[model samples]
Target: MPDCQHGLIADETETDDESIIGDEAHIVARSDDGPRGVSDLTPEDRDKYDNLVLLCRKHHKIVDDQPGFYTVEKLKEIKALHEAWVKESLHLDKEKEKDDLNYASYIDTIAKTFDFDSWDGWTSSLVSHGQPSIRYKKLKELQTIPNFIVSRFWPKRYEELEASIFNLKNVLNDLIKVFYKYADEGAIDKAKETDEDRTIRTRKFYKIDEWNPELYNKLSEKFDYHVSLVEDLALEMTRAANLVIEKIRKYISPKYREEEGKLLMTSGPHMDFSWKTFKVEYKTDEKKENHPYHGLKSFMTERAGRDLHYGEGVDTHYLPKRFEP
Candidate 1:
């Protein structure tokens, strides 16, 4: 048989220090670059081929013979097991939040920030069933009240929170559109179809028109159907971010705008990569200057006047007359 060590055995009678077979065999985990030995293999080891690797005498004996030493496979298995356990535990923890704060926290925070007292009842309803915000009392009330007339301003100021409702409405529209698209393309049938049939039908008969033409037409009349609710939600999210800054400016500090800008910047470009990490991106200057009210800049500027005020005795800060300090 060929020797496991250096190429050819020069002498049969050579001492342990010279004979290659007499040299210790190192055993290690297959994933590791360290030393390991043959005796380290367990009788019940599942991944025999994947769990062990070999090395030179000194390195092999150092790992195999030492009291605290480990084979490469054993170390790798231990590490993998630990990582799996951690992931499973984390998933369980997050699952627990699904029924409580995870679902309600965003709506709750927005309601409280806007001083809408009826958010509690809505939170209770959402925990039982994940319905749209349109079903919530606060949102329903805001919907009936026009943006300009809800509060005390002469021209009727629409707060970021109020405008966010518009965003929510837009989301509702998109979801409805998707619902209609599926309805048109046969979402209802798809819903009722067996998993196998649905898969087959989707591949065979699915199209962007016809599942629910009547419902699509109705939603279009209500919210301009072709416009995506996602776009509306994006605008509202930007508004929400700005409103937060406005509130901070009044009670915290006036320089809060700078901090808010940083926060907005860090959120990154908004794109619906997945439902898991979805966020709305800020609108660009062209969109802002040309269509501020319907886009990002309007969301930010709507709250701009909230932090500054004018009085009769004190010199009134006029936009065209004087620059804001």
Candidate 2:
């Protein structure tokens, strides 16, 4: 097999220099490296993505020198498929890396980010040097290492895992800022309405200003909006945290983490919502059946009404009161 001419597959051959570079093998043929050849590759792509494929000297010449015989499309397709198969077979094995110190440290990178307040932000989307918002920038930094450390490390949940976190961050980031904005400056900018329907629904929740009756009358509908927004933000954020926990559960066995004393984080402030969405009616009905009843088998007490308690058990880790950035 070592004497064979094929670089990828083993075969019977009597060649002395079976795997030697140039004469017996090619990483990517000299001709194919060109734009007009069978394999057009950039430096980074070739270096990082395993864009280069080896071939025996005989096949290398045929692949590179003759574009008609070996097309660029076919080579790219083969290279892509091969890389995928390799990842599917080895790189996605989470159980193999459960006890790996490097990987555990990598997981800590994300877990610790939540511990500190520096990566948090408002949704003003502050930009610097033509870059994305600061929060976006921070989240991006967190994402880049996961794949490099271990490709498809999160397995099937990876897609929604990233998405839910992103959404959760933005939702809370925006709501936190909006809450502060109304506190600092009584009225929101009417022109920058992003979600009018949700805003309308959120309007039924609170009354921040009591002194200015005119402004109160004008924006009374939206007084409780922050409550609804906070509740939704908490719900969405917890859903995201659950996805992360689910992802961790996928690869690492619970017994392993328990044995090793590594805490599998499922409970955090971001994963807890101590608020509720209150449904309010603009007009109070004269009919006692519409109101909440203390005791009776009346239609209002049985089906239409019951006591509403905003959920309890608040955790600040998921939604911190003070954010550094």
Candidate 3:
């Protein structure tokens, strides 16, 4: 039988007539003497594909000899299961091919939006103490990346990649918001006036016009905290980006290489930043506890203070330990 324990296949080239005679067993037998012959099925219906099951001679005789053991329902179930297995085996390759194309498309979209080739130049402004350095046009382009990422239909197999992409998006959005808040518009315009290249326009963090000792201390602390947060987010974003790149290389394309500096913003060996030494957790409800990018809204809106902690855990501890003059 198709689901026989012996796992035998009928060879049409065999010379034995008895071997092939009952090879095509019927669930509701065609004649009264045959197996499961008590059914009221019509002659044509008994010979139909639904009623027939392909089996070896041994199982055919066994089933026919003891029709009570292998009933019409049992044979029908066996036939259905066997056919399902065959169908899945035949289509496996086609499904894999389709998934490969989808993976390529998704990875390509991420890589293009990241614009890794110009990363170093665009991020060079951060070397000057986390200033609003990204070009206006470039920042605008970067802002659209999250939309593209969320719009894609990701497969279950790339869950980790999807997660990394979302994390990067969250950090990037925070950085952009911070830039917009503290950016010195006047400084940017003045810089554009001095520079011949219009593309060289850059923005800096706005400084306090008149410094009262107490006000200066408060604003300075907030400014420093914001700068630290920006730097930390940038590093976190880079880490997430590298994770996505690695996954793409491992799963989608082996030939893909990580871009130079891995899209990390670095001033020098001494100015490098990392999140490993400090613990940072975003606020989220129980349902979203497992999500890596949770509580992004709260993280952005939280007021900077002396403690620098937000939510349940210590969320922002990576303040730059610079020496005061």
Pairs in clash, predicted candidate 3: none
Least lDDT summed over 10 consecutive residues: which range in candidate 3?
305-314
TM-score per candidate, in order? 0.24, 0.30, 0.54
lDDT per residue (tens digit) for residues 127-172 in model 1: 1111112232333333433332233222112244334444444333
Model 3 residue 142 lDDT score: 77
Candidate number with greatest lDDT: 3
TM-score ranking from best to worst?
Answer: 3, 2, 1
Which ranges of candidate 1 are over 4 A from the true structure? 1-133, 144-151, 154-227, 230-237, 240-275, 284-291, 295-325
RMSD to the hidden true structure, all candidates: 23.2, 19.9, 9.5
Indicate the TM-score of model 1: 0.24
Say which prediction, candidate 1 or candidate 3, comes out ahead on lDDT. Answer: 3
